[model samples]
Target chain A: MAAIRPGALDPARPLAAVPPGDPGDPGLAESVARCLNDFFTARRGAADPTDPRFDGEVVARLERFTLLGGKRIRPTFAWWGWRAGGGPGSGPGAAAALRAVSALELIQSCALIQDDVMDGSPTRRGQPALHREYAEAHRSGSLRGSPRRYGESVAVLAGDLALAWADDMLDDALDGTDRRARVRAPWRAMRTEMIAGQFLDLHAQAQADVSEPTALRVARLKTAAYSVERPLEFGAALAGAGSGAVAALRSYGSDVGTAYQLRDDLLGVYGDPAATGKPIGDDIREGKPTLLLAIGLRRARERGDPAAADTLRGAVGDPGLTDADVRAVGALLDDLAARSAVEAHMRALLDSGLAHLAGAPFAATARDALTALAGHAVARLR
Target chain B: MAAIRPGALDPARPLAAVPPGDPGDPGLAESVARCLNDFFTARRGAADPTDPRFDGEVVARLERFTLLGGKRIRPTFAWWGWRAGGGPGSGPGAAAALRAVSALELIQSCALIQDDVMDGSPTRRGQPALHREYAEAHRSGSLRGSPRRYGESVAVLAGDLALAWADDMLDDALDGTDRRARVRAPWRAMRTEMIAGQFLDLHAQAQADVSEPTALRVARLKTAAYSVERPLEFGAALAGAGSGAVAALRSYGSDVGTAYQLRDDLLGVYGDPAATGKPIGDDIREGKPTLLLAIGLRRARERGDPAAADTLRGAVGDPGLTDADVRAVGALLDDLAARSAVEAHMRALLDSGLAHLAGAPFAATARDALTALAGHAVARLR
Candidate 1:
């Protein structure tokens, strides 16, 4: 991937136009990128003057990894959330708000980097994962310890740095603002909930839990809270929104976030690989206890289809599953009407979330942006 | 390994007596322990009511691990540093100071737990390391996927939680205080420096660089800064000390902290295993590029003793080194006068640190306590 030129990422650039009706703010993306670049430049300068290797190994790579790719969806949502809470769109206050929301990307950076280590993913965003890159460096340098261990250790430290930096950024953004207390609550909650949700996700997989409630809980905590609800609440809180507005945004975020994950669950099985940039059926092969699989399994058992139930149980977690096996499972799910059920469930969630937004006392533009974002979230690849 | 009863730890208990002229404070230990227990209790209460497993797995284990065993050296130093900065020994402010200093233990928790994961150590503080405990649970439960991976992942999450909780504690302790900004700067710097130090350590190990400067740099960054200097600065900062006092305390901490590590290096090879609770000669076996080894190698070469130099190079870091090999290395080091040189260096560092303390304007009791602490640190196992 080509390196991003820091100079080109100007924070003062005009907001990019949203194409026709899709949810976007290219200007927000550029400004967040600029903010991250400036932060990293300062951090690099602050690195131990006695040890130049530190800047090279940790900070530079972190900057490159962060700048390389991400849709900046979290920041976008936060922006709309702030707007809905009556935050201005332009001014020093707006700039600070942008800085605060941009911090979400750093948090995202921490999550993805650490998750790659946990999952042993070799690549991210079409490039070598941070750990893998470090491991390769170790191997080339003839390091003494296990290369893999060194790589993972380095990656963990890198992730820790990112997490710490995210906090620093948020603190800087809230420096002179009276919203520190209000903003901090959700920020703290978001961090803990994300980790907790990750733990639960791991636990569910370990226990082979297929219950609908467990699946929904993981989705709500891991995806909804970290990806949507908390970000919305964080923005609303930063704007000093009243309780009713914060509550409405939170509820709306919860529904939309769950719906978004449900859509992802479907795409994991059936979306075009080229479009999704993920292998179709990989989730099934891993036997992830997604809501789709949970519902399908329940329906199969409830219908007294022993063959289908047995096949589903045997094939879901089989690492050696072939394309034929995935096709069979898909066929079984369709026959049980699990696909239709999940699709219908997803739509209902979206509708309910939109209704909450409709009744909320928010700026008209923010309301429209949020509606578009929610629709775009669930309607992807539809 | 007996579990500490929370009720038995009272923050308001009278200060325990110290051995004549020894740096000690049993009351401080009790207060810190009580503060931690109270924090954990509240955190447990705040765990999702819908997910008790999260509390059981993450928070409870972290609490048990933290409360189990530690000399609480960091907090002790921090307390003295605060006192030296004119902080009262008893009052609501003192209580807040205790709370803030207690945060160092949590940061230590993060470091140690993650260190074990990186080093692949199976035990710590006379108990199974956190990762090992979780790995065993996975093994016994016959969980899907790699038990080792799951355990490490869980440990990583637990460490992340500890890090976040430490920040929360510090923030709480500084709430509504004018010292928030002052305290935050060192707190932020400490966190980053610790992680940077860790990265540099791994880099040194990977490259097998045995230069004196590299070894000293690693010692200063990895141990001195995190274990001593930063904690002292954090306390002094929290007390809003003047630049001269903070600078004096920081300088004192630097010398004493490095001396402490040098002494530790000696103990790693020569101290009584029973007394230190560590295997003697393990450092040589692992070929750790300690200052002792660095000095020994340099002296051997300077003396034109090819045999001594070759043996030193070959025996150090040889995993399969026998007792005889260790004995030979020790004899050679003594022959080269490396041990005497390191001893003299350590004493000089301690004296220099104490002199800095003596010249600084500080409370009488605090100065005395710091002097004792410096002596205790470098004179260990003497």
Candidate 2:
């Protein structure tokens, strides 16, 4: 949490990246990875044999999924957030901060696993999703019953365990800190908000919502606040950030987070599978009721192109969609300029978020790192 | 947690009830209800409109499910365990103690919601289960997509929230206490054990497991300890119970807990729907791979009753099983003496559990209350 002083990270430099290997950020990422490695190693060995409840396979699967390469965006953002609150950038206290921030990854694991199951996603991070892996095992004759159901049950339990274990990990970070309640307050809020947001997203899909506001709200709740804002708050709270700083982070984080989700929505429609680790048009097939679809639909009908609108509608949620069908839908959206419209929207939001950091009382390194993170959040093609 | 003492609730008493309206237990129940009522009321008001994330329906559904009639067995046992550790039976401290104990209900709520969804259970407590209610809503036109999928998604989020919220509630109980870590140690263990047990049970079903030891292991994980033993530990820890007291309570609780599940499995087959608030032969319909079924199958084969064993197997896990099918299986099981055999096993477990409590270091009134609870656990029709 930092004061939202009016000025930009460089009002002239619109989300420009500094190439790869940014100095401190890479170390931050490495620290989080190391923390996760240790956590999993400890867990893998701690499986009790006397207690049949401690299944070896569950531990292995969980470890595999956790290490399957996420961008570690949350922890990166949290590190800067803590630094913004005057936490140590490196040295003795940094490990504890890093450990605390890594918890977001565990929580993310929970969300991703459950979300994949809910979406019926076949793959994640370019590999079979957790449920699909389990289903495959069942199909391989290792188990009975409906393979799909067994797979899903396993996924659900795995996700629940991740959430519980996330708290346990956070406990390690907060131990003897005398700030457990303070730190836990935001962490608890973040958990509830994420779940609620997920429910909303599901409800929107269920009701086939087309309202842009509703979709934006869903994105903000499910992605923006949960992915960006809350992680920032968690780190801030961990640093005992003051109310002023917390409010600044709230405004700056939400705006940037909104930009992040807007970019994600675009990626769902246009990003390459290799880069995104998801199939093109999968969201369309799932009828996600995302902002992109909402904008495309509304704009097409507004232009008196009923047939174009029809073509877009035809591909919105067609599970049987062919590659050709997806391209045609993509072409129509391109024709409507909907993609650029969203891109412009995202750019403006990101710029506005960066503008808030002007004159803020942050260490120079934190400011530079946050600026870099802002670039990644907004401009990353992946 | 309590030490495993060697005495009985009274082996010769035959589960004799102490009449209706037992003195202190009803008050304990009321106190828990009051805590839950307040928690829900606050949650209901906190649903912010600006955030589409929070849904009125979600909160209402969770509240309805939580309050809809559970035996509150865990909280009661926990309270006694606490009393056995010198926690007050009544007064101001009782409220805080009760709050901690009642968190178990929230955990139970999570387990029930997810379990129902996983089992595709149509009803719970003689009412439509959570997923069923949501699916029915979809069928009635308020939502779209696969009704079952939407319903399950909602139930999963609901359950996840219950767990997260349970921790939040526990935080309130442990607020400002120096003993937070001490109490949390057992709470964490209980949480992990119960989840592992659920997974084990699910795994058993998928494997079509028949080993009696494996079945018992699953029960111990899934039901006995979660429902009885850990709750006692939670209460004892809250009361600062010594290791000896904790160990004694653990023994008394687990044995009684084991009997509780054994009786439950029998009731699933033979208990009246009116009394149990569940349909008869439900376990068979769901293919739960219960201990009773394992015993029946093994005994039928051993007794040169392959035909009876076949008949029982035919009924096992038949989702479309008819009343006639259930009756035929029941008859075969009766012929194989599996039902009586399980009843005998349950009685033996109960007697042994009561035996442990005889020398437990509990106050006289706590002893009386626990004795009554033990009777209720094993012999109650429901």
Candidate 3:
């Protein structure tokens, strides 16, 4: 039941380090997509004949939504983490690593579907949010009940299904791997942290907590551990890596993940809608307590700029905010130096993460690819 | 890695067969409660200090709601299933069986919480629904955003946490057991089936499908499998039971489970709020696609009584139906003999289930205990 095959860890045979393409995975993305396609195809076919509509309504939509679009960033990090931990570049072991890490995307699917219902977002990845789509179908199909409620209810079940299926996928992936127990620890932690992070995000909006500390904590739990650290740690565990390498990967993951979320904060306000696939100024409209907003608000009050502070307070959480209003607020933030301050912070975090990677005892090739990933994570437009 | 200890399966040394007191488990209840208490206590204490609010708002409430009350029906069935499969009466293996079965309660918690939000239920188990509670707090505290939206959002997250924690609890229970993979198959199927069943229920309501077949299908998936069959099968799997015994238990579970749902439908329309802990006629008001309503409608139509059919249809799914309207519908169902028909069907189901038990090679004590459970399941007022 050994996870690694003999000579798999030989220094002379470094793991593959495929370069990412244009802010996303090129080579690994297909493998991940194909893996998911096969899995869902089987699931779809297995839909009970007693309820044919279940397949059309739920299973089909889930398959389409999952295969629709994602950056595949989480799986990429996990794959590289496995490679860095001395897993062979090819063979059943490597294939299992790919399948195991692909489960992260299903987790991502659950988060996004649930988040949309919670936020009442209109769109995701340029398509109507899953709930919104279901709601629209209800309206058009002349279905009974409140269309909005029906949509949200269906979406919740859909998210729950994805979460359950993700666990099943992980179990399938670990079928014969001796590292199942090792991978379970991080996987379990990641799921709880994801839910806890979401709760905090909701609370921050409700209580209007705009503190930088709260913002960072949310980013660390919601994004850092979930998006980077745990995925890397999970992959390393899958390879049975020594504690030293696992710790280093975790350190690097935390820094990079935080930076990545910070970058997302910037994108939420400034990134093009076409690229980010989100409405402009959604964070402001939803009153999300991101680090950038906290800094902006703090700087305004500290500088005794009551007018700027008042403008921010008035615009945030205002669902009726117009695009023109958003542009004006963006200008105000820039004038207050909040945008530049966050950018500087993001750079510092990324630099620190790379430094961790530099000192880690990872295979030579994984180190190079990891550097490229850190760069793309922070610098990407979307 | 053997699941059973040597000599643990001796027929002469039968497992404990504690009689259920009143409507629920009296003997096993305390053990399940203590196991949950210790687990949640550890979880609450482990809450990160950075977000104290999360602990109070999310984790603590989850702990309270889980520990507050439940009939512990699923766990009781699982325990009996284990005994029927020849698991030891008491020891570490027995304790693990209890711990593993208790996870069903958490899953129930998740199902109940999310269901309230979906159904817009104001109360549950004689208290405000979790979402309603959160909504009241938002209004009283004057929190940001729509109180309704906030409440639903929070409830969704709470349910997600419960589901995730339930899995972790099961994992902990299986840590030293050799039956992890065997237990996993049923566990995985049950999770998907639960969600899928829920979706079908929603769909039936939305589509206005009032057929008897659809009603039975929904009951089979939602209640039969999730509440009874899976618990029995899951427990049997934990004991490493052979296929013949497992099949018999499943047959017994399905019959009893469907009878249980039929009883629930009757109670929803006719039972006292004092005992049922739900408002009278709530199901008709909410337009739930229950077997009783479907049968009543079918019988009315088949008897060439359009007036009766119209009255039944008009009364059902009417949100503003008065208490008198419900009473009229109940009288109409009785006059059509629909009530007697359902009662007969339930008796037949219970008899069939008991017959399965008689045919199976289960221990004598377990057989008697399971028969009592079946009677309680279908005959109780609640």
Candidate 4:
């Protein structure tokens, strides 16, 4: 109940002291879902429908959208991070830990919804994006104002609600003073970094600052830090993990997380559309300044292929860009040795990150899970 | 430092036991300003400019917009509420209360910025709206992407940061466990209601649900609850006020807060543009579904003035509305008896609220302060 001392936490015997999660990964995911469901049910019970403070439609949409399908990657990472930091590994203890970590999913939902709105993206995960969904509803209902504006407005509130609700859930999950105090820094840092990263991304797009350094900074803050590094750190903090284990997790998270973004950028540009659920080379049309684009541009300029470099410039960020133009851009990237260069970089990051995991100060199975996750995350770098 | 006993807090004696605030209202405002300044300065020092996480332009704009002029109404209410519940009235005690309560202002900034964006208002308090300011910056710089989109994106992040930073300030301001626990519920509810209120506002515009009940509901949630009731409750809670005092504050807050909205509605339609910093009758052009509008429509209908009703309809929600049209609409509201009806209603609410304060369980001077604030808040009704 008091403030935790770093030396008092048993970071050495983490997962080794307990059995594997009884229901394991799938069961952990189910527990997280159940926790979320119970939380929302309690909220629904407490709120009066006629209060105007909570509109039925808004609540329903938020509930449905958040609970719907997506890989629960962040929550899984957080759970593993806790296990890596000497948390009890099974039974109700495991359930409570899962509940706390599940909060990350809600924050992720907020991030994705806001990101989609900011990008003017119409779809996400093969479905209408949150803003688009609300906009369509407005149109269908024959609402008075501009459907787009109304949709965007409500989506903003919905995204904000997701964030506030996540905080509420985390408050409910943390039972003691030590846990709350320890988690506060990482929790604050995670939200701050994500929001700042969003601004940086927008700034990059506005300024067209496409250096590899700029690209990696965006990847680190927006993707790596927000998605991977912070979640692990937060979970470790919640478990009152020692500095050594925390450092190892951060090291592994930073490298593997950056690799994930590099691989994602590659997929956005050249991976199969059916497999990735996105149109190949769509990033070129949107003119998103990913590392893949940075690598291509660098190689083209370095090799003194002026024609290829010019073509790449013309293709990327062109409003009137066509599928044929994307195909041409893809060919140019392949010819310029740009694609292989990024692939090599991703490989190096994953290798380095996995080596850290091997020497990480955690019990056996959790370390193995993180190593496997790193490989799976960057497996798309074909 | 133990859990507060409500009776031990002495909600009845309130401000009478303490000397006149060593720094009174003006000094309290100054302290709030200083606290905010210190917080932001620390944040600036801690952030590395070289790190992409802190965009200099974004940080600077957030600081400027937050520090710029406003009445600081919410913070004042919170401070007085604390005093009314027997918090120390002056010295370091006053300073601590002000620091914690001033967080409401940052939240206010977030609300105003987001409201301006949602309403697509070009200006706020005689300056460019946050989104418009960012858009202007983009255009002046001849940024690569859509200026409007970039502006909106950055504004969203800025507003979010304000909310998060406010939490950080509040976290620092709380010195003990009991105060933290006391503040959590009201804090959570305040944010929840404000966000919900925003949605209700947007919904009203979208649905064109001009029923008086709908309008009243919007006022209650968006204005009465968010801007008034919750802030008072939050402060009293922080001071460990008994439930009796809490209930009385809520009763007084509800009535006075609704009157405040009524006055605001009146100003929107017919008040001096120079004083209000808004164009006269601008709400009519936008067809904002205020209770004033609802009353006008109902009066026109009840009086069998179909032509007047039709004229009113044609006047409101017109994008190309001219100055002459606003004058004509003003004349129509007068003829329909709608303007006086709203004025009479405002008076009744204020009178009823003042009566509640007279019986409220607080010190006589605290009671006097509430009475004066009520008058000041509704002074524009004329």
Model 1, DockQ value?
Answer: 0.61
TM-score of chain A of each: 0.90, 0.91, 0.92, 0.90
Measured by DockQ, the strongest candidate is 1
- Segments of candidate 3 deviating more than 4 angstroms: A1-26, A380-382, B1-26, B380-382
Tens digits of per-residue lDDT, candidate 4, A1-382, equal 1222333222221221222333355455566677788777776654444353465766667777777736666777788788888776776666667778888877877788888888888888778988998899899999887899888888888888778778778877875444777888788777778788888888877777777888999898887887788888888887888998989888888888888888878877776666566666666766677887888889988898898788888776676777667777877787887888888888898888877777667877677667666765555354
Candidate 1 lDDT, B88-179, residue by residue in tens: 88878988999999988888898889988986766776578899999999999998888898899999989888888888888888788877
Instruction: Please write out the lDDT profile of model 3 over residues B270-351, one tens digit for every residue.
Output: 7777767788887788787888889999998889999999998887678899888888888888899888888889998988
Clashing pairs in 1: B287-B317
lDDT of 2 by residue, A1-382 (tens): 2332232222222221222333444455566778988988876655564263455657667767877557777787777788887787666577788898898888888899999999999988788999998899888976768999989988998888888888888888778886677677678767887888888888887787757888788888877788788888888888888877776777778888988888777877777666666788887887776777788899988999999888877776678887677777877887898887888888887788887777677767677667666666555432
Q: Would you list the C-alpha lDDT of every candidate in the order shown?
A: 0.79, 0.76, 0.82, 0.75
lDDT of 1 by residue, A165-188 (tens): 888889888897777888877888
CA-only RMSD, every prediction:
5.9, 4.8, 6.9, 7.3
- Tens-digit per-residue lDDT, B274-382, candidate 2: 7677888888887776778899999988988778777777777778898667777777777788878887888777778878778778777777667667766555432
**DockQ of all candidate complexes:** 0.61, 0.57, 0.57, 0.51
Model 4 in CAPRI terms: which quality?
medium
Q: Which structure is stronger by TM-score: 1 or 2?
A: 2
- Which digits, one per residue and each the tens of the lDDT, describe model 4 over residues B30-92? 666787888888776644442534647666677778777466667777877887787777766
User: Which residue pairs clash in candidate 4?
Assistant: none
- Screening candidate 3 with a backbone cut-off below 3 angstroms (N, C-alpha, C), the clashing residue pairs are none
